[model samples]
Each structure stands twice: as structure tokens, then as C-alpha cells.
Target: MAGVLIGLALLAFWLFSLFDVITAPEEEVRNVPKALWVLIVVLIPLLGGLIWMLRGRPKVVRDPWPVPPGPGMPKGPDDDPDFLRDLDRRMRGED
Candidate 1:
């Protein structure tokens, strides 16, 4: 019973690792190439998953700087003078 449970757990882990390797962006993967990682995960299952977990996973990179607002972006209609002017004109029934 315990052996069967262990085997099932390994199978799940292998499948999860295989999918992660395939779906991960090429530039993000580390160590061996993505193609080789796929083969290793497919061919060796348990050992392959262990190897990937240990060596092939990518480290996530986070952007430290805040993104600047794009051109002509307004925080809100109330805060934008042009938008408020347009709203006033519209309210007065002027096209």
C-alpha cells in the first residue's frame, strides 16, 4: 500500500514538473536546454523531476521600478481639465 502511494506521488510530481518545463519560457529556463529538459522529464520521470527541481528551475525576476504612466493618461475625468470642460459642454447641450 505504501509503495503504491509513493509511486503515485512520484508520478504526479513527474507530470507536474514535465508540464512546467514545457510551458516555461525558453529564456527563463536554466542549466540544460529546454528540449533536453523535456526529454529528461519524459524518459526518467522520478529522477528527471528531482533533477529539474534541483537544477533546471528558473529564478523569478521582479521589476523594482514602478512603471510610468503612458502619454495623455488621466487619473480620472474629474481630475482632467479637458474632460471636465467636455462634460460641461455636454451638460449645456453644446456639441
Candidate 2:
């Protein structure tokens, strides 16, 4: 029935929210302490879940492109200009 489906959906949402709260990193939790957020979600499932999703969740800012390593941190031999130049000299029989 429609009511049963709605109940199941709400239950699923509550469970997901609870899991999220438990797994969220301490530094990422906002508005209140992580323990307090967990208590809120456990005590008042629907409203707490909504509030957490809206306010407590971390504001993740993802870069579209992968970040290159900082200067002097070569990711690979090919990426290191000095290595490549040395390799080229060795290949050409230069000292």
C-alpha cells in the first residue's frame, strides 16, 4: 500500500542519516558537536535527519580536475624535467 511504501522510504532515509552521522569525520560536522548530532538524529529521526543533511553535512568542494603535485614533487620520472634532460643526454652519449 501507499502508506507502507512511504513508511519504508522514511525508514531508509533515517537509517542512511544515522549511518552518515556515525561515519562523518569529527572535523567535518557543523552547527553542533558530532556526538550531539548523533544524539539528535537518533532521538528524532525525520526532523534531525533533515536538519543534519541541510546544516551539519560537510561542505565538500571537489575540484573537477586532479590537482598536480606541488613544486619539486615529481609524480613520475617523465614529469621531472631534470630527469628527462639527463636521460636525453645519456641517450645521445653526452657526459
Candidate 3:
């Protein structure tokens, strides 16, 4: 029947919400603590699931890309002008 299908759907939604709450990281859960959220979801399935969806999830934060190293860094001895000059002098046998 239509009523039975609706009930099952609601039950499935509630169970999914309950599992999400139980598995969510402690710090990521907002408004209520993880344990309390689990109780809420289990005790009053439909309403609690709605509440968790509305207020229990953490906002996602995207980090900015890190700055690259400055030109002061040399990739290798051959790429450094000073090192190249020193190598040339050494090759000419200068002290």
C-alpha cells in the first residue's frame, strides 16, 4: 500500500541519518554532541533526522594553495651563478 511504502521510505531516511550521526567525526558535529545526536536520532527518528540534517553537520572549508618557494632557492649547483663561477675558477686552477 501507499502508506506502507511511505513509512518504509521514512524509516530508511531515518536510519541513514542515524548512521551518519553515529559515524560523523565528533568535532564535525555541530549544535549537539555526537552521543546526544545519536540518542535524538534513535528516540525520535523523523524529527531528529530532520534536526540533524538542518543543524548537525559541519561546514566544509577549502584551504588556499600554499605559496611556492622564492627565487632565493637554487634547483642545483649548475643553476646557481655563484656556484658556476666558482666551478669555472676551479677548472682554471685558480686558488
* CA lDDT of each prediction against the hidden true structure: 0.90, 0.95, 0.89
lDDT of 1 at 29: 89
lDDT winner among the candidates? Answer: 2
Q: How well is each residue in 1-95 modelled by candidate 1, as lDDT tens digits?
A: 99999989988898899999999889988998999999999999989989998899898778767766567777667878998999999999999
Lowest summed lDDT across 10 adjacent residues in model 2 is found at 63-72
TM-score of each: 0.61, 0.67, 0.62
Candidate 1 minimal-lDDT segment of 10 residues: 67-76
lDDT of 3: 0.89
Q: Tell me the spans in candidate 3 whose CA falls farther than 4 Å from its real position.
A: 62-95
Clash totals in order: 0, 0, 0
By TM-score: ranked, best first:
2, 3, 1
Evaluate model 2: give its lDDT. 0.95
In candidate 3, what are the lDDT values of residues 1-95, reduced to their tens digit? 99999999999999899889988889999987899999999999999999999999667787667755468877778879999999999999996
Model 2: per-residue Cα lDDT over 1-95, one tens digit each? 99999999999999999999999999988989999999999999999999999999888879867788888799999988999999999999998
Give the better candidate number (1 or 3) by TM-score.
3
- Runs of candidate 1 exceeding 4 Å displacement: 62-95
Q: Write out the backbone clash pairs for model 2.
A: none
